[model samples]
Target: MNDSLQVIPLRHVDAERMMELISALVSSAGSGQAQGGNNQLKVIADTSSDRLLVKGSPEMIAKVQEMVNQLDTTPTRRLSGLRVFRLKYASAGHIADMLRGLLANQSINSAGATSTLESASLNDASSTGAAINNAASDSLGSSAAAVSTSSTSGTSTGVGGRPFSIIADETQNAVIVNAAPELMFEIEDAVNQLDSRRAQVLIQAAIVEVSGDDATQLGVQWALGNANSGYGVVNFNNVGASATTLAAAALAGTSTAGISAAASSIAGALIGIGDSRKDSQGNTEFYGAILQALDSSTSANLLSMPSILTLDNEKASILVGQNVPFVTGSFTTSGNNSNNPFQTIDRQDIGINLNVIPHIGDNGTVRLEVSQEVSSVVPGSTGNASGLITNKSLINTTILADDQQTIALGGLMRDNTTTRQQKVPGLGNVPIIGRLFRSDNDSTQKSNLIIFLQPTILRDGGAVASVTERKFNQMRVLQLVIDKNGTIKQLPLSGTEGWSGNVSADYELMPLNPLIPKRDQAPKSTSQGFTRVDSPNSGITTYPLNR
Candidate 1:
């Protein structure tokens, strides 16, 4: 064995692949020379920069050089300035896996001339019959398989696979991939197919929660769903309140009879309750009984209670009385109470008034002015005239685009109801006698009302036409002159006209009637105020006299 080492310089061979080959060769030489002597091949590789250096015994150096030479003989292609195609809607991992699959498929079609990194390492190691090196190669192949499985399964952290790097350059709005040029062409083809398809615009929607009573909620839902109202698509969801809370609010003057009515209607609709041929009076009695039972009992308990006939008119009236004062001969005197009588009596009523002003601008701005007024009879008060609660709200604002602007039309009242029921302690439990022993009382109150407003800008044909007209008005006009012959002529009256010479300068004037005689050639006038003229250049001249 020689004591001196040999150095081999390799070119065009990947440093990583060269190092793996050298390590395998050194392992083989070490194991093969272990039993014979202490002389073993020492292999060291310097892979910094582009050059790869390998130092080992002559035989080991010869083996590595042979592998490099074999690699150099294989067919290879080079490409530059190739762009990486990216799918806007696809993820990076998805693109990476697709490229990996494409490479694998192409390798298979080419009879495996281009082997995977793991397989190549295994083949190079197995070429030499060294037990330790073969075992190491097997272990390396297993680890590589595990890593490839993890990467293909979409668990790798970086942009692309281990073999190449795929990066997204947001500044250029493109992706850059470093890989074999031939494979990049395949990727470009796939990406071109993706780009040929059209992209879709997605609509983003939101779910809004509106807190209100049944009537107001139904009205808003209907308005939003109506096509003629121009509010686009809207969906309504009903998440019912707890029965205990609903009943408590109803009984505590915080909820209205409308709520109970709505709940009953919903319950009846759900259960398929049908109307029968019952008289109006009988129907009234049926509803009255239901209300009475529901007033004192829970909704669940009301189902178990037996139905009964009850009369509940639920009518209310008001009376006003006042003492009168009499005036006799401009002197006031107090009148007797018996002589005075009640003057006026009227039922309480609710009044609502609405006013709105909308100003639309040519610049796509909208200004809105809204006013709302509400008046209702106050609860737990005497006399219908003086127990009125009036509320008003005014809003003025400007909004842009199709964005929604909400104005709180508050101060409108929500009817609050208090339900009171009187019943015998034990007899109310009786099936037939319960109706006579139980009575229901209900009172009313008022709470705040909330309103939501969403305004949308309608850019119809007229608006578009106006915008186009404004744009047209902003354009500048270029002046030009046209001649009688239907040809455009340049300014300054150039060529063949008397004013052609230096248009900026003044020209000599010419007489309209140059044939007329001059003052020196004309004859002098006589005492009769008549004169005759003759000129050598003129043909004839005449004069007329006036009386």
Candidate 2:
């Protein structure tokens, strides 16, 4: 349907009516008088100039013809179409200048690069390096050049008489250091640093910036064959890969209570504190887990996963006992029962779950800053306790770039032991001799310490006095962007897309409004044509379906 139409100004036509007419004309023409007959329509217009170009078929021509007849008596109105916006940056040229200035002010290269090569060599052109060293040494003080070899056995000419040459083999590449060895090393090191820096930049760009094919490849690489790593619980008793016994492992130790317990821990880890992700005390929650659901081989695979925060052998065993679906194996003990009473531990499955805490964004997307709360229960034992102490003080640690950085609002908790003591006194008796004789075992603290990462809106505590619960609730959602340098920045996503840009599915934009209804996420698809059937009993004619 490629029919064209030309029209003159009309006294009766208005912009709205003209648009409607054009739409009808285009639709009628494009249908090719085939699919439901004559329903084709496609038009392009220049919005600002009120210029219109219409294209379609015979029926569309007839429709436009009717519109032209009406327009002959009406006033022509301006046409509106797809808008082409010319974005004008407020400080376009100045942005570059400003960035350069900032870079200069920060002395961009001053931060010594982090990674380096273990050992390396550089190309040497002239024998200037050898000559310079000779010039400094007494042996060749007045000589034009000097001879040297990487290996002690190789011979070299003395000073000025001959053009001194150095011999090197595959084992080592010699640098004719016209300067001191120290200076030569320094130059080589610098070159290596540059190479490492370039590689790092390329990797970061590939993983973080580019989307589509490159981003998918990076994600696949990150996950790799981790799914089939056979780490979960697939290898108990060396079950055959295709054995029917292997399939039975899923239900081996599964019980409603067991699954519920695991789900609880996962839920807790995911839910953050309070109205926002922050807890009552205002901190971002982070969770970790160690799975024991699989055999040693499978355990190793599970640990290899990037999501793992920690993975001890004991934890893996517990996970196995619980019978998580992803893992499969015989839930029976096969090892010696005398040494390890838990030999039945193999047959009698167990599991350890890491809370599924929401990960706060690290980049400049999060508008809030939070102090995390970490719980530790020493489980008052007669012997010394070994547990991590977090949130007591900040420590230096590096987070790898491949890890997840999504903000979540949940957590999980699981109890592995049932042993309990009613009371214990003098739990901290002096030294070895006191411990043996101490029977006052009342109120000995027991149980695991669960540390949750918390998020907070206040950058500094001073604003806490002015903050109301309503305001806090209003700021619950957050967006963040993180760079490889470990710099965390908060970017408020309350407005249009914020740091996430125009991509709709990448992130969920939730505004903290108590009164508004919760957002619905349903798939949207194109609708089919309208129906037209009247009441059979009445036999009354109805109007045609126009839209």
Assess every candidate by TM-score: 0.20, 0.14
Clashing pairs in 1: none
Per-residue lDDT value at 338 in model 2: 48
lDDT of 2 by residue, 207-272 (tens): 011111100000000000111232222111111121122223222343335323432432111211
TM-score of 1: 0.20
Residue lDDT tens for model 1, 173-224: 3445554443354456665664432211111111122222221111011111
Worst 10 residues of 1 by lDDT: 129-138
Model 1: how far residue 187 lies from native, Å: 11
Which segments of candidate 1 are over 4 A away from where they belong? 1-16, 19-55, 58-75, 78-547
**Clash totals in order:** 0, 95
**lDDT scores in order:** 0.35, 0.27
